[model samples]
Target: MSTKTKVPKQPLSEQLSVGIPDAGMFEDIPKIRRVAGDSAGPRMKGKVVIVTGANSLQGIGRASAHQYAHNGAKAVFICDYSDNHLETHKRELNSLYPDVDIHPRQFDASNEAAVKAVCEEAIQKYGRLDVYFANAGIATGAVFTDIDSAEFMTMMRVNVLSVFLGAKYAAKAMLLTSPSKPHPSGSIIGTASVAGLRSNAGSTPYSASKAAVVSLMQTISYQLAGTGIRANAICPGVIETGMTSLMYEAARARGTEKKIGQLNPLKRGAVADEVARVALFLGSEESSYVNGQAWAVCGGLSAGHPFVPGRLS
Candidate 1:
């Protein structure tokens, strides 16, 4: 059985009423002792990966890129529509994982040509494309009355269309077997949200876009069945990422930080690494049998609404 590493207690002022998986709390590496017939290396060894929406320092895409490189991915292409943080992120990742090839690109993920080009680039350079994480998405809090058609369309284009393009192209790339890749095997991951599963977590357009993502993965997974490729989605709850930084900041300003995720059983908002770890798992061989599923990494919030313990009434 695996054991978790406990963190030392913190002072009251700095104490959190919630908990997160700390540095040593979870094991990301394969077991120290390898089993016979195992790959005999790190979780992502020799894999070529692509992650979209990776510019934000506190975003899941960035964190996932780091996790992939750390886990022995041969190359990780990190991309974002915005270029402001791309170079900086590349530098940081390169510094940390000198052996892993880290490439940063600036492009709109919703653009079919761009998405196709990226997949082709990975194939040309690495001879195989192992994983594609379609994590680029936009969110809004506009109420129904304030919603505009243009804005709503833009949301779908960025969030839903992007994932569609990613899956379409990535699957094509993964199917192309090369000398390095003896089989048609790969993983395609999309970032959905709990908002997609139900209401109250996002605005109309944002939620609709994410819902499309969830459905897209479900259908795509079946389409790729028996191709040695897998398609899946990650529906994250409240996380302290660049997209949700405003909400977190507001709660902190009101000195209600401890109540950030009070509705969830865990009672805490997650960091990017927490969600990124899930992406890493889907991208690796560890999840070889997992396909066509929407995995909710929402601190059990999606299990059901929180209720008073030992008080049925």
Candidate 2:
């Protein structure tokens, strides 16, 4: 025989109440503010980095540049094909982090000569190039029938060819400066997309271009083997950048902004800074062993088809 303590029961209403809040509750979720990394210390100290596709004030390239500066990168060359916002971006970042040298370059990333020149510029100016983020690319949604051959070629030129140039030239620069560092080392990061991993995220050509980008990183990582340099691709899901501004605006106009990223487990679209954080991680020494991989920053969307919590479909 065992003595048992009396069990207390909750009220029926309390027992039956659902723990999950309604989706409406998400409307008031706070925006993610950009700040230095958790420690707010010099994490990328003395590193020199290049970030392409950085003209947009609200883009991952600009955000990554800021992240590098915030973490004490000695130099950050922010390049873009468009010169329109490059100066403005430079000013804004300079105001926040005066110590970080921010160079604004205007050149088409798809042009092999321009890419090579920028990489050489970094090596010439800084005597080292630790990271090169090949982040410049376009977004499109035209379906297969609507897209003509020229359109497909344009997409490939801007997206696939650019990353190829980035890897080829950035690797050369890194190799040139490897002896100056402790080891033959560098990091090359490309901006792929969840669309590249599967269908439904982008138009056919766009998805193909991104898939090529992912494959490029994987191939180059091994090609650069034993050199200590790492190559990786970041596959972002639904991020709120200039590329997706129209989608966000339309959603807001239709009063459906809260539903922006419902397909993902997190149920909210991410900002550029969120993606930038991952770029910073790949660029830092903490990820020295992280190589030849495509990191999905998709808020668990890539884990599988999102399902309702506590239930199976």
Candidate 3:
């Protein structure tokens, strides 16, 4: 609701031109022919992927599942703690991609047994687990000193431990099953946040839990090396998801809405799809050599200080 506009230090086009080659030079090259927009690349074709926390209407999990299905994944297993909402998301996805297989299951990501059972169920139904996005997370707003022990434990169990259980079970399933003769084996992606990278005022428990996700990803990547299972974390900035929406609303209620998106160099917030694309890239073979990395899809918000209008010359 706050209309404060913070201009970025540099524009996207300028940044893109600096790093990438001119497309005109490759326009006439036979190897550079552009595929039709409607075509599904073989990158994820026939693969089975599981995504957690996909039931939320404005979360990255839903967006990632849709992208995976659109990219020709054979089956997309959606797991969430909410049965009714999960069914709704499953119905929507199935309606959108009638030919694609969409499997919806009710399970709590924080529960180790539930996580393991879901992984096994997906493998039994789909034959193999190719991609797993451990995206289920919870956020709580509390000052570091005043935070209750129980609240801290809940955040850790849901945000950090859930990722650990997901990676453990998903990797176990992937190791037991062999990959397609030509395609690579498997990938595990965890969703961290900018909070994990930097301190967040009044969000100590949430930030600490997200930080744990980064550590979990690094440890999992190292442990899964040589097993054809790559692990990575997607560190998204303030996207306009259900969780952030609540935060924004709370800020508005407290007359502090102007602080939203203030830390990002990019003045505006990102949509869920922006983060989902990075998840897809990490889950696909295009990033075959990319492992143990935290890909930040933050619209350059994390690049530098935001240029406030009156504060700057």
Candidate 4:
């Protein structure tokens, strides 16, 4: 069955509308924000970026794609293997931002040939590649004993292998940036999960795959030592994307929607664009020194166990 059949209409336009400036800039300061200005301008202006798993209207990839364009990317390539709304999303972004180029394609990020072709096409069409975000992943819930082997393996390919393949091609492409540059520079990011950082938070296969992605980024960072390409991962908490809509629906149906993220310190889940902003930061020059780490955007869910001081055994 297609995942699209299970998906509901999304608020992508509304999310993007409020998050990134429609035609302005975003400043990166110590929590001190700014409006459009020379000092605080589009972070991705003139850069070519690609975001995989962008078909879902409300997924992190979609939000990142719009944010990238809103910030002035010369070209943004996005794709998804299952999203039925691929063309619709591409057209929407183009219609909203006439100056920014948005190319939406359909392909499986886990396939080697497909991944290579996407990278090649981006370079051929856009002239160069500056950032690659391997954000395609799936989550499944099942007891360890009940999970099938094939399901586990597929999760690994979707989450872990996709990251590897994207990084492999992104690093090679970033090396071709203007030779005059003193050092290599490009970003390779993947979406991990707070579940990957700890146990008992997510199902077996999903957690394993996400954990591998975190490790993959750390190892890739070392592999691309002098290439100027940085590797990192984003571990998000519960966000109501299509991937987790089933979970959200269950909570809503049970009159427990308000408790969805109550386990975290902030006591609220994040929006897709919130995670996209972090992606924007990692891809921009502001994160020049950030690399090889899994940054959690989970409202402090993974900070520590919620042990009350006097209640401890």
Candidate 5:
């Protein structure tokens, strides 16, 4: 067995009661070891948060929603459109973190009225919205010639438009929060793709939409300057999620699943939890200085396609 150190798991109730993860707890978390050693855990601590597109079992939004609750968020509004398991999931989350107030809602995320309503509900319930994770997105699996204007627009609405709406309403709610509150000006996180970062492989419409999402975050961050509210995006590389399940299925059929992320230096793909970890950081106080930045979480794949440097296996 590997001799790696293990941090004793915090009892769910105590984690909920403690509210904030302290700087002293940083050494315990393996994934959150800030290189500077000034890192901490449970940075959220009593904040009311929202995570969109939390419908899928393998999605980043779902992972992030639970992380917020696990870290002692005062409330977590988990949302998606018409998932049969939403209620069951809600019960599970409540049982796991009884101290948290978990609310599950179903609505069309791209719809402006619906987006505004959810933010309004959260503010009314928790008195403020600290984090809004606009992670709902769709992959347009078609080339330019095969895609129509309607399909293109749908992708944009789901991917780019959703972020715009979340930023608008979430910022409004955060600004209303009392300045005396710990995080009066809050964080807004969007799930962008590495395909948006550069001309890598992906659908044409999907690429364009994600590129717009990245640009949207950069532009909005500037718009909210000095307001204490910040906006940022995460550009994730190959990960095994509902969006990319087809790729994994095909590879597994041929027994080539191990080679899914061979192009990256790590030589393996990631899971929903990996990207969710980044979301947790962006949503927490630890990222107070981080704003208007598009971060790449692709295991160095964004650096360049890995090429063998004369050492053939």
Candidate 6:
């Protein structure tokens, strides 16, 4: 007599069945934040926001500007050194959001006088600035050994000095302007980078400059602790923007696309919008209690492998 082993049957949900009231159910997901009763719209209604380096369409600054405007900000001040591009961005934003208020200004953020003048002009126009996003920066791809002294200085001045000037003026402006009766506070955000947290192989100057920005944000946050002006930094990693496009192209030219992407645990880069969302969060009242923090928007890349040897396991 031969005996066969018994086979257990799978559950009804796991088995393919016809017209059996589908196993998976769908449900409405809750919104992250609500601005009104039973409504999920415009968390930052009526707030005034300022975003620097907003001229380029493929930049973090422009992304943040659009996010703020979409989230119900009353007015957005878009500042950049490119007058024509800034005007174009202004036109584009106005066309997209007919009722939104966008103020475009051309000023070199690295220039102390220029930053101060821009702040004064914005205050004159908007009456007060509730949030300031200092998102302007420049990076060079040269290695430390190959970089010239002038290049290093230029990178520092543009990347580091620009943030300093922007924060300095924005903080001063916020201090003078009294907040609304209920919301007695303001926010300031700076753009740092993963390069600031850890050293990049070939971008020493860029890393150093961003590290300085992190320090600046921390210092400003401490100085304004009791003044109701919060300061923070957004450190992005491998974001797919104009800046990262250049890096990606360079990597491709060097035949290292796979290697570069493999450097991050996510196995992919992030879009400018991803980083912009974080900036918007920090700039909005949603993060009223978050201050002096360097929020990493790098898609877990910064949290992954601290060191990777080129030819070792």
Best by lDDT: 1
List model 1 lDDT by residue over 114-168, tens digit each. Answer: 9999999999999999999999998998897798899999999999999999999
Q: Where in model 1 is the C-alpha error above 4 Å?
A: 1-40, 307-313
Residue lDDT tens for model 3, 1-313: 9885543232122113343333455466634433112234556788789999998888899999999998888999888887667778878888888878998888889999899988898778776888999999988776778888988899999898999999988987776644352222578999998778766422888888888898889877777655667899999987888888877778889998667777666655778999998888888877766788877787676566556668766
Model 2 alpha-carbon drift over 4 Å, by segment: 1-40, 178-182, 307-313
Full-model lDDT for every candidate: 0.87, 0.86, 0.79, 0.83, 0.83, 0.77
Quantify how close model 6 is to the true structure by its C-alpha RMSD in Å.
16.5
- Model 2 whole-model lDDT (C-alpha atoms): 0.86
Identify the superior model by TM-score, candidate 1 or candidate 2. Answer: 1
Clashing pairs in 1: none
Q: Using alpha carbons, what is the TM-score of model 6?
A: 0.80
lDDT of 6 by residue, 1-313 (tens): 8685443331221112222233343476543432222225676687788888888768899999888888888888899877667888888889887777998988888999988887777678766767888888887777689989999999888888888888888877775644352223578898999889876622889899889989999988776655667899999987767777877788889987766645676766777899889987888767756889999887677786644657576
Q: Where in model 5 is the C-alpha error above 4 Å?
A: 1-41, 179-183, 306-313
Better candidate by lDDT, 1 or 2: 1
| Residues forming the 10-long window of minimal summed lDDT in candidate 4 | 7-16
Best by TM-score: 1
- Taking all chains together, each candidate's TM-score versus the true structure is 0.86, 0.84, 0.81, 0.84, 0.84, 0.80
Deviation of model 3 at 137, angstroms? 0.5
Score candidate 6 by lDDT. 0.77
Model 6 ranges off by over 4 Å: 1-39, 178-184, 249-260, 306-313
Q: What does the lDDT come to for candidate 4? A: 0.83
lDDT of 2 at 300: 82
lDDT of 2 by residue, 30-146 (tens): 544322234446778888999999998789998999999999999999999987998998898899999989999999999998999999999888888889999999978887899
